[model samples]
Target: MTTTTPPTHLPPPYAPTDSDSDPDSTFRHIITSMLNSHHHKFGFLIYRVNYDNDALWQNYLNIIDQQTREYVVLEKKEHLLPHIAWTPMEDREKFEGATKDEIREFFRDWIHERSEDRDGPGAGVDNTELIRWSPRYKACMYVNGEMMQGAKMQTVDFLPGGPQLHVQGKGVVVDGQYDEHDRDVLRRSAVGAREDFEEVEGRRGWDVGWMYFTLRGVHMVYETLCMSEEEWTSP
Candidate 1:
């Protein structure tokens, strides 16, 4: 996918001045820009494990597979279908039955091997990391701050000059800075809305500004609200 260079002189991060103004517009702008600019074949796979309940896990997998099937057709993209990859925890063990710890170890090692293959010497310049984990599961592919543990979660390897967002379950959360290399790439496109808003509202009283406007903090709040609305109405 293509990326626009962030503006050279981006102001400090945005902060909200009032309750009514939404800050998530910034995130939407960034996400939309990334999607439009980058034309790569991007997709995601989610694997779910229930510590003790095999039936629940299987039900969840079937539900997700069915949903994915619908989404593939709707997107008119075949690649999006088999985009989901699932393996049950129970099946990971043989008849001798490896312990959960052993299975986890195997899973990690398997993932690392795949990552190495995608990024190794003969693998060209391409780099990739698989398996991002979060404490909670939310809707598929609509990740945001409210559904995650924020700072405590493991970070994913962000692609340079590509779409970068946190993935947990089926959702994508947009928070944190992209990797430093990608940050540099995005630096040129960075718009300084925070400073601009502060300048415009500098003359107003603190209470008035605070009551009437919101800074960058509003971005998460707005995103949460929007996602909530979408989930509530979605079939």
Candidate 2:
């Protein structure tokens, strides 16, 4: 819940744009811009921290009375969670016939319990806080062309004197091939690799460098990445 300020020398924060008008768009923009490499001298590795949706959904049912439907979800704007839907569970029997508003209320309450308003023992961990607080997505930067062998590894701190932004403060490239944000580059990868992109905790190196970003720093990086290729590397 705490945040560190970004270094002042970096470019100004990025202004909100219609380009990120929705959650899906916002998520995509964050993932895309951070993964883009302005120069071959810079390389990026990212790992997405996906929600344990299935397990969390099952936890929600513990509060429901009696047997409920196999699936009970409410449609949300988040594209990553499309399989979920909303429906009345056995708890509806209380009202004899749950009204539309009642069903919505029940669903809303379930959502709230997962994040806030439910504490103490057996309240369950807040999945929302887990998604928000835990580095949902980790990004690593390989500087000085370290991505290619035979090149000496070097570190680059985009925001210096702010927060430590290197993986263990040593220039090390994360092992394994990463899913590139560039569509063309991604398409060139083997179909199987593309189909089953690995999910990782970033304990290795993906969670290093720009892993944790402040609000201001995020905006700065987003704006910097969105800049023209020429502008990106300019002094």
Candidate 3:
């Protein structure tokens, strides 16, 4: 049986013109709409790794830690974290015949181990905090564009089937799927966002801006997922 692929394409970086709505305003609208309609509690956290070039992974772990801490404080109420998962390209190729359930389990176990207290001395920093780790897989590119004066949007696409996080001014929107082609499109899309934004900035003579507001999409997904999972699995 043929499988359907998920839609994954990074939207080109856009700068508002006289005729365009303020990017920031539009971003806020999107976020507010998402939060008001979606039945999930989402939040974001940022972190830097002490060493290594894997900033994404480090950031992911940092966010996870933050979420965990929040979960503890809230007594696992309101905020729930998502199940962490990853699918390395090498591993996927090595086990081409692996079933979806098997792959999910593999990632689930990997995430659980990484989250365990034994991963390292600092693994469990605080029972009240959660750490953010990088996404399980790598994307071709992660494009972050300035949506407004202090706000930016990040769109990422990874290889194989995965999820896309849209970071807007008010909140985040996450959509997940399991399709290789969609993954490819998302990877390329992220690259496109980066290129498009860079080109606009160069042409307009604007300095590179700090990403804010919209960069929390991933964190939102993680928190919502975590909360939902906890509720579902709770006795």
- Misplaced by over 4 Å in model 1 are 1-51, 86-110, 115-235
Clashes of each: 29, 3, 33
Q: Please, what are the lDDT tens digits per residue for candidate 3 over residues 136-209?
A: 11011111111122233343577344434333332212121123345445546655432333443233112121
TM-score of each: 0.27, 0.17, 0.22
For candidate 3, give the lDDT.
Answer: 0.28
Question: In candidate 1, what are the lDDT values of residues 7-96, reduced to their tens digit?
Answer: 122122222233223343333322232123221112212222223444444444454344434434533434333322322223322312
Model 2, position 74, has a per-residue lDDT of 16
In the order shown, the candidates' Cα RMSDs to the true structure are 19.5, 21.6, 19.3
The list of candidate 3 runs beyond 4 A from truth reads: 1-90, 93-99, 111-118, 121-216, 232-235
Residue 195, model 2: lDDT of 35
lDDT of 2 by residue, 59-157 (tens): 322212111111111112232222111121232133223332333343334334432222221123433222122111112222211111221212345
Estimate the overall C-alpha local distance difference test score of candidate 2. 0.25
Ranking by lDDT: 3, 1, 2
Ranking by TM-score: 1, 3, 2
